[model samples]
Target: MYDGAIIMESLRVGTSLEAFPLILRRLSRYAVKTASADQPPVWTEFVFEVADEHAVELADALAEVLDQPGWYADFHNDEENFVIYPGRVFRYRRGDQLARAEAQEHGRTLGVPEPQLDWTD
Candidate 1:
């Protein structure tokens, strides 16, 4: 299973994520507290599962929809990890520290806070 989580708040204006048929198998929602005035105090995260075969489609969709300003989506399967930012997607082996660092650095360059750059490997 390809498990991933997306914060509902991270979506860009006028953009809606598609509920890919037979791809998204499960979903869960949770609230995250934020102090920024630009965002709601409680942000809802939509955690989901997808079939591994749809990784490319998922990455492409996420790359297009994630906001350009520091927003990203992370998902992983048994052997690979995907880190997606607006207009960009990074694929790395499960345990590649170098690739992870590169992705994190890219996030930082996008003005993503260091804490927000934390994504499961």
Candidate 2:
């Protein structure tokens, strides 16, 4: 099932952050297995990066969001370095169009394919 299902369940019951991890754990029970090496379970984490030039502001913003439960790291390979859960990943982008553009640039630099963009008429 998609993460939306888990989120919706949480929202319906008014879950708190303290309780979010437990909900995530329960959701993991229903996760479908992939062909990855070990078929890791699903959990959530926040992935982020900032240019060395903007490190300070990025650090401050990261600090502000750290209270939320999720792993944080700068390097993509380092993500697999820690296993609080399995098959968990989240990418964070600073708000606004400029930030979105920069994220696309960074993704390209990392050899990640650009995501398809859609606009509703």
Candidate 3:
């Protein structure tokens, strides 16, 4: 097994049907694979990478949260940020500043409580 963490970003956002494919695409570089949901609402396999023991601890915490039905987790490097939604990306530094600006300019609606900044942090 490799050393990494997974993040399932949301639990009951929008709908699982629309989110899984996008999640797969974003993390494809890490070789993500899917499995049957076995439970209702379809769940897909999510895998990613982290560097050390602390990351491993973080990964375990993420897994615990994801164990609930309809959720998943995949962690990426700290330097790398995540685009939680279409046209909406977030990083550790600015939070949702850039994405919010674009949303305002285009009059686009954005999902709130941005997912990129983990509540645990």
Candidate 4:
């Protein structure tokens, strides 16, 4: 199984939420959380775990939908991490700091606040 979290508030208009309900169906567990951050104040997310098979679909959908400019979402399996930015997706080995830094730099350039770029592996 792969664990992932998608910020509900970061979704952009014109993108399909068709994947949302489908993702929930396979989830082993889930909960909603309002992120504790200062930039945008509170960003709510749906934290969940779905079968590994959903990773590709989830990444693609998130890339298409997440509002760019400091907004992103991520999920990971034991061996890999998938970070999705608007129209972009980055997959790197877990604990790979170099690869993680590249994704972070991209996020920074997109105007994502520094603190918001932190995603635990």
Candidate 4 clashing pairs, residues 3+ apart or interchain? 70-112
User: lDDT of model 2 at residue 100?
Assistant: 42
Off by over 4 Å in 1: 22-40
lDDT of 3 by residue, 13-121 (tens): 4423221212222342222233223223332334444344344444333433433332333334444332233322232323456643543332223322223223221
What C-alpha lDDT, on a 0 to 100 scale, does residue 72 get in candidate 3? 34
Worst 10 residues of 1 by lDDT: 31-40
Candidate 3 ranges with C-alpha deviation above 4 Å: 1-26, 29-34, 37-47, 69-121
Winner by TM-score between candidate 4 and candidate 1 = 1
Pairs of colliding residues, candidate 3: 4-49, 4-50, 5-75, 6-73, 6-74, 6-75, 7-73, 7-74, 8-72, 8-73
For all candidates in order, the CA lDDT equals 0.79, 0.28, 0.34, 0.75
List, residue by residue over 81-105, the lDDT tens digit for candidate 4. 9988989999999999999999999
Candidate order by decreasing lDDT: 1, 4, 3, 2
Shift in Å, residue 21, candidate 2: 2.4
Candidate 4 runs further than 4 Å off: 19-39
- Model 3 scores a TM of 0.25
lDDT of 2: 0.28
